[model samples]
Target: MSGEPGARRRRLRELLVDTAPLRQSPAFAKLWTGTSIAQIGAQVTIVAVGLHVYELTHSTFAVSLVALWALGPMILAGFVGGALADVFDRRLVALVTAVAAWLSIGTMTVIAFLGVEATWPYYALAAINAASATIMGATRGAIIPRLLPTQLLPAAAALSGITMGAAITVGPAVAGVLVASVGVPWTYLLDAVLFTGAFLGILSLPRMRPDGERRSAGLGSVLESLRFLKRAPNVRATFVWDLIAMTLGTPRVVFPAAGALVLGGGPVTVGALTAAFAIGSLLSGLFSGPLGGVRRQGRAVTLAIAVFGACTALFGAVLLVTGLTDAPRDADTPLIPAIVLAGLALAGTGAADNVSAVFRTTILQAAAPDDVRGRMQGLFYVVVAGGPRVGDLIAGALATLLALWAPALIGGILILGIMLILLRTARGFQRYDAHAPTP
Candidate 1:
């Protein structure tokens, strides 16, 4: 058809080489390990902060406000951080931002130890942490391509998912135990310690200048990304699809309330549910070798998202059934079956979402021009980071007004339906080739 398919496949193998050891590259391996360890700590703080905030306020609405407070700052930081990454050495940018986040966590630890019950300071620190994290997140994505070969991007992405899944799986559970046994202060301190791994990783990385002229970091760079998006239809579409998938399908906003109502109990249920999603994602990454070899990454992304949506719907259905059976709402009653089933569904969703992330990230990294990659990556981070938050708000509203299951079920169906429609109309996305990515 297009050429000798077998030869192309052979070339792809040479580039990707599944059995090739990642450990051979000390820099790549170190970066991966460092980020993974740091991620675990980050998750602990996530759970701990929520618990701390809730304990002080005892209001679900207030807990949701944390998301809102962080949203705008994160978006602004992502855009500026990206431009900064393009201009300065990315490694330095990442390290500085990481230190900022670590210090914020450390500060929180002190506040907790002081027995400060005030919520405003926590909220302020959370916003600062989020902003720093946004910068670090964008810089890291830009860093991966520099560390590994182009062909290995998919494999690297898969491996990243594995680390992320592991972190997610353990972080919240560990946070719960730490908070319960020791206290919130300890959780914050632990995160501060774990944060060292990330710092070490970035510090060890070589200096990385932009591929071209270092663009000035200002409105000029930010405007460039927006202008590029206006012209780059495929990249634009990918963003839209991801935004829809995350905005519609993210079910986490309801987890706390579900624990209190549908799933029964308190933070324990929340941790278990979060762990289930990570477990599923980890399982997928473990089997990601086959996925790395696939072509047509765009279609692959669409299919993965559709599967995610379906599984979310299944999770919702399970919740509905549990509600109908008059499931336990008390902190005392066991909801083993419901929790397990929901976990299964979340796991499936996690796997599918990871697949989508691999393709979407690859497209952005490969297609975008070097000079503009930072800003574009930043905007991409904003959408990627912000979408779930919007979904959280939506989920909260739906859960408050209707049954908890209503959001997942309705959102799932909407994601699937919208994806199908968009894919059908945008034949270009379906026809996208992994070997020859378009900007």
Candidate 2:
């Protein structure tokens, strides 16, 4: 794809106006709607779970344990689930996973309604929910490429970013309100209701099968995808780049501590900080009219990541200055400037991150073979989804070892340094073209 002749580089104005073919595809619209709805519920549950766990134990370690609890099962299930997506009907895989997730939410609702104060049950239910969601995401992501034409892949990715932005924006804010007003039980119940849309979305897709030899539905299939990743230089590079960004820039794990110790705003502050970032992402996607078609997407991803790192570094600098300067950490005192500046920095990070996401997803869908797309998408999801949780664990641990501000400052510097090294080392990824297949 080439730009208009002699066109001056503008302020991503295409992102400001609507363009492209995905909006015309009814099937894509329906899928986007349903996924967005379910995602809202998913985010609500995430906030509720954290609040509930903290309420029970009042331990930051307990909150971090949520990630540790869900990590292994999600990874293992994601791999097998991706294989199932390849071997069986993609619709069936998604539908079944949705059902499992719905049931998990329902079960949690019952537990909360029954007045179970024990934290173990919440952990158990969260692990189950996380596992199902991992599979559902893998299947759903792989299905998008098949539902639309190749040219519309970027549009689909942009739309998907919009859905995520909406979900994150609505879900956490709703979770905050519901948890504050109606309590955790009602939050889970609301999620149960909201999840119905995803069921309808996946239920309507046409039957799909792997375009290759159907292998046994087990570990062997997963290993096959792993081997493929090893050879796919561009795909591998995408994962590496994303891992660097997520691990180095994910500041969310420090939010709760920031709320309690640094900012003196408590849980409400934590939720607001989370929502502010999501709001930025939503705004970016809503204006993403021209993101649909682009060439040299690899460069776009690298640039986005660099911007993300810069914003994150700015955020850390703000926190460090505030902490070492006049900002008070007393329980009754507030750091208004620090809070406002951090929110702005996080918002910028969200927008840059979303842009990278739009390009990275397009590459994943267009470059990989359909027969093994599920596994590749699963790995993609794992990197994108799981990487942050792992980052959360790192941030949480580091925050405990040092100060709430330390993790962000160190993580930001690390992300910038690693991304530069990766960009310099990876040649094929830098040269990747949106129209061609990767090998």
Clashes in model 1: which pairs? none
Candidate 2, 230-328: lDDT as tens digits? 888888777888998898788887787777777767766776788777877887788777666668888778878888888888877776777677556
Model 1 clash tally, residue pairs: 0
Q: For every model shown, what is its TM-score relative to the native structure?
A: 0.90, 0.91
Candidate achieving the largest lDDT: 1
Clashing pairs in 2: 15-287
Model 2 worst lDDT run, 10 consecutive residues: 1-10
Q: Where does model 1 exceed 4 Å of error?
A: 1-21, 257-267, 326-331
Q: Which candidate is the best by TM-score?
A: 2
The digit string of per-residue lDDT tens for model 1 on 1-439 reads: 7679988887665543253327556777888889989999988998899899999999977887777788899999989999998898989999999989998999999999999998989988999998998899888888877877667788887888888889888898899899999989989999999989997679889998879865689898788778988998668877888998888888888887778777786778887787778888887877777776778888888888999999999889888888788656776675888888998999899889888887788788777776777777788889987898888778778877988898899999998887788678878888888788787
